[model samples]
Target: MNLLINVFLLSVFFPYITVIKSLDTQPTALFLGTVLFLIYFKAEKKQNRYIFYILILSILSIFLFEKSNIMMSIRGILNYWSLGIISYVSYELFKRNKIKNSIIKRSINAWFILGFIQTFYSKYFFKFLIVGMRTSDDRGVTSFATEPTFYGIICIFFGILVIENFKKNDCILFFSNLLIQILFFSKSSMVVLFLLIWISLYILKNISLKAILFSSTSLVSFHFIIINFLKDTRVYKLYIKSSDLKKLFFEDHSLNMRLSHIFYSLKGALQNFLLPNGLTQWIEYVRIETLQKTYFHTLTPTTSARIMSGFGGIIYESGLIGIIFIGIIFFCLKKGLKNKEIAIFIIIISFSAIQPSFPLNGFILGMSIFNLEKRRIHKNEKIKSNDCCRN
Candidate 1:
């Protein structure tokens, strides 16, 4: 089980999969991992029984509704069913093996090295460029991914692993981590935001109130510096021209594209709460003026027309039912979390609100870490009670 789990992790984190397009419809990691794990470890049957059945039934519902659109069904399977099962399997396997500090550190190193290699390869050999970002923009390194944002997400997850090891306070590793983000030119704001959260938490934990005050003041001043500096950059050119708050958010090309999709998704969710269209579903049933703009679709994964509705996509794709399933999993994970673990969750969620899909990798990592903390706290409490009885 441990060896298979490691291979599964490699398939997810490594750049071995040559066919990126197949990922849209196939469960590359999930399918392969399931086969490997099934060969060795008997699948956990007791706890996951109800959820597994529910998941299977929900997937079959799509086939009943529309058999012609098998592609969308495939997308639904890979995204919802396969990802859910495989992630849990990863979590369980991780627990069974007693996930170690060494394993976490080694995984972080793999993510960083694989990311760097894939970025250069994508830029020079594959030319996997996004719509708004240009070839010379220096932000076009997507690694093995078809999009830079996804690459950014992978980097951000690695950053979380680094934070797990951040207690060491390695200055060189810290700077190098930041440098990697700069090279990737990942559009996702998670890199900076996550780093800030780590720094803030570390200070609050280890440093004095005076140091916290100093850091807070520095961050506030840095905000001003960034505002002034960004107004001059190409990315914020539209912001400089538009003084009106409405125009600033609604008219900007980059911002508005995402904003429009989010709006469409919300409206669609309200209108089609029970049977919302899954991914790649562009049915004419949805009648909204704004949603028409989201219709453009090419075969490529990073195409400008890809359905990117942040949380809205969840509601739009599987309706309230899907949201309920996710909520159940979330609350279940939360039951074992400690106060510090909850604080860490708030940080990841802040970025998750804007990301196209739920940050599942981050969720899995957080839950596993929190479970470990819960056990440690339990053991400490038991020890204290034993000492009191002895006294």
Candidate 2:
């Protein structure tokens, strides 16, 4: 039963699974979690009063402020409530020892392996392994992910995990991740790489001038190598567009949308007293005339849209409530890993870049708590060994 729950939780991360793809990822995760929760039926209770409080406040906010749009308000409530439930259930499972980090580690390793396989057989037989495999993009390999950005984020996260663990297969998995990131060549990949290095250095006991020089030299060398050898990839395209800000803004749809989301969502949050306009109501905050001034006025009320970021969604939808909301969720997640700060840094980084996925968020929180417990157990063992040595 515990193993079943572990697999179900891990399934949330691998969105490309055919069964999940056919059934839809988020709802399936929620449904399976619900069933497992009912079957296992642990009467053990944990205190998550803060989450419930935020939910109550958010529901009340919708009624008080968003009564004008009854249907959209309901949608907002449902979205928020569903994700809250997922986070709570995940927290409970990990807290109760139903989830395991070892399984997560294996899954991450498998993802990297599949990434290599997909690089060669993407057009031939990749679909046999992953659903919705794209055949057109020759720029890079995305493994089972839907896009380069998602793949990049996954590599950074699991890459960190593998590095920390130092298993016999660590070198192979680490290099495989690095190779895939280079091939993917997306902005998110490069940005995450830079941030990871910076954070790793910052976490060290001392920041010497020599270390800084070496880091700069390595980064410059890497940039030059990419420009000279991987010129056919998207990084070179970004380099060429860097010369003309106008072309960069107008030509790159991905950058344009990202910038637009950040700018408009931030503007909306400030304009609306920092309260979210309601879930999926980001369109309401996006003014057509204002958007037309920037030439991104292509949005419509009926268009399916989100703020395309975690903080963006939180701030745009809940405003000031978002602070309390994220705080509570973060608290539930625990410190996570030895370098808890970096783990959180990566979470925020990914959340801000990717569209909000509740299942993924829940998994992250659950996994963090699991890591905390693992760390405690290891600490206890070390203490016991020390006592034996003293005796």
Candidate 3:
């Protein structure tokens, strides 16, 4: 409950903070400080090799760069890494019985409920809170993202939660979340939602000609009903413009812009392939003043570019050796994908392309997937052992 409340407050009030900023440094600092204090007082074995390595890498990277901006960027990266550590630790705590699954479920429910209400307030009620708050541009939309992309990502997460819960037969939770996502009217989100649903159906072996026909008919009917009833409203207009059927596969300027941006990012990556710099430096060189400006002007770099930039920064600071080591780590991770941890690591990397950078959310998600894989492995091993004993 406490964790959920904290997340809700952060989401509602500090929406501008990137997930790394919110989940990594602050929470990690507090957690570590308390743990250290406890260790000192109780004479507990406070050994955490991962945390030690993370801290050392972060500090060493800062000194290696010796550039204030690069150091700052490294700090940001460390913050994000810290969040991942925190999430993993939290998951471990749950796995070790320090926390209950029921608690986690309840927390998730609370978060969804809070998110739904806050989004509603932002859409409807917040206008009258302040004199200048009612402007169309400022009226309760994502203040953090310069464009709607971030909201789209959030919608994707929400949609994932909805689908996952729905598969578990939590219909009310699923529908509630779906409604919230619909209200956001994000094109990227709609596309992701469709993809997720389709993939899930395929995975479940529930996809069929009849199912497809029924889904198509239902979607078309829903579209007609929406257009007939809400055509004149702003929400309707936004929905029509952002709908997956209309924008993703049909015609949409925003989608075109994103496609173009992807090209530019790839170009940038190729140009800076050997000597990548940090994203902050690239932004500075590009004279991108703010998040909104960068997004609106299509100046945001691509995921490949960003990773290359980070690699480049390392090279600049620590030379080819550092880059080589990092590359090796990545290579090993790729090679080990059959291992659950590696698969989760890959998903985290893939998700980073869609998100701004690797943040707490990505970290937690990676850890969760990794843990799930571990559990499956354990169960499989147990089953095999049992079968052998019986034989």
Candidate 4:
């Protein structure tokens, strides 16, 4: 049973099979929802049971208030609940020592193997994995993911898992992730954001003038290397596009779309008194907000036009409730992590970058659980040491 659960947990993000065009549905939701729904009947912990309760409340909220688009709201419920289950299962696996070290090693190996296969046969694999979604014609290696940027995001998950599990013998996995980000994905923003947080934490741990100077120098050198050598990469292109404000706003459809999410989501939330508009209504809100704009015709009404920013989606969907949800999430993360600042930094960086999607959300929470359990054990050991010394 544990092995089966582990397999499902690991494969949650495995090249999602889209079911609905507008909603961007993944089949894993159905599998997860069915399995976890049954398991909830036998759950012992209130923490586990509360998930279903929340799901029920969310469904009720949709029925009660979501008159504009109830079906979309239901889709949202299933998607989020399944994601919540992924997190729950991940927390359970790590907490109970069900996720073996060997499993982690094998999963990382499988990631590389799939990446290799996809690299050589990009067109074939892309069509097989993704359907009815927007994609870049000149995208670099996407592995088993739908797109290059998403592949980078997926790599972030594996990177976190590798760092958490193999502290000593992680050089291969470390560089492999880096290669995937830079050479394969041709996008380094994810890596840069992660490294910045990591370096910031390291400096905070060992605060000194020399440490600050060294980090600053290293960052500058890294930037210089990227600008000079990696001109073809997506981040570099985006950077180049940032020079002209007018061009950046109008010409860069990608940037413009992302900006619209931020601008309109905030505007809509302000007008709605910080209350949730409705589930899956974010794209509609974006549509309504941008319809008057000159560039409205250029934007699609499909899921591709949905909010790319996770934090923005949260605010746009739930408003003040979203803010409270974030607070609770990070508060728990802070309690679990040794360095609460990492949690804070992750939240800040993820504001504009991370997309709010299935399995990704759950995978992150599961990773947080890993750190949380690690911290708890270390804290217990310290308390025990203090008690023994006093005695």
Q: TM-score for each prediction?
A: 0.67, 0.73, 0.54, 0.78
lDDT of 1: 0.49
Those runs of model 3 whose alpha carbons end farther than 4 Å from true positions after fitting are 1-75, 79-83, 97-152, 162-167, 184-207, 210-218, 225-261, 284-360, 363-373, 376-380, 383-391
Pull out the clashing pairs in model 4.
Answer: none
lDDT by residue (50-87, candidate 3, tens digit) is: 33343344345443343556655665455334433443
Please identify which of the two predictions, 2 or 3, would achieve the higher TM-score against the true structure. Answer: 2
lDDT of 1 by residue, 135-248 (tens): 334234554444555555566555544554345565247536644553334433334445456567657665888878867875675456436643433334443455685656
Sequence-dependent TM-score of model 1: 0.67
Task: Please give the CA lDDT of all the candidate structures.
Answer: 0.49, 0.58, 0.41, 0.59
lDDT, residue 140, candidate 3: 28
- Model 2 scores a TM of 0.73
How big is the RMSD of model 2? 5.3
Better of 3 and 4 by TM-score: 4
Candidate 4 local lDDT, 321-354, one digit each (tens): 7776566567655665545555675576566646
Model 2 misplaced regions, further than 4 Å: 18-25, 38-42, 48-83, 96-102, 128-132, 163-206, 209-214, 243-247, 287-292, 295-304, 330-334, 347-353, 369-391
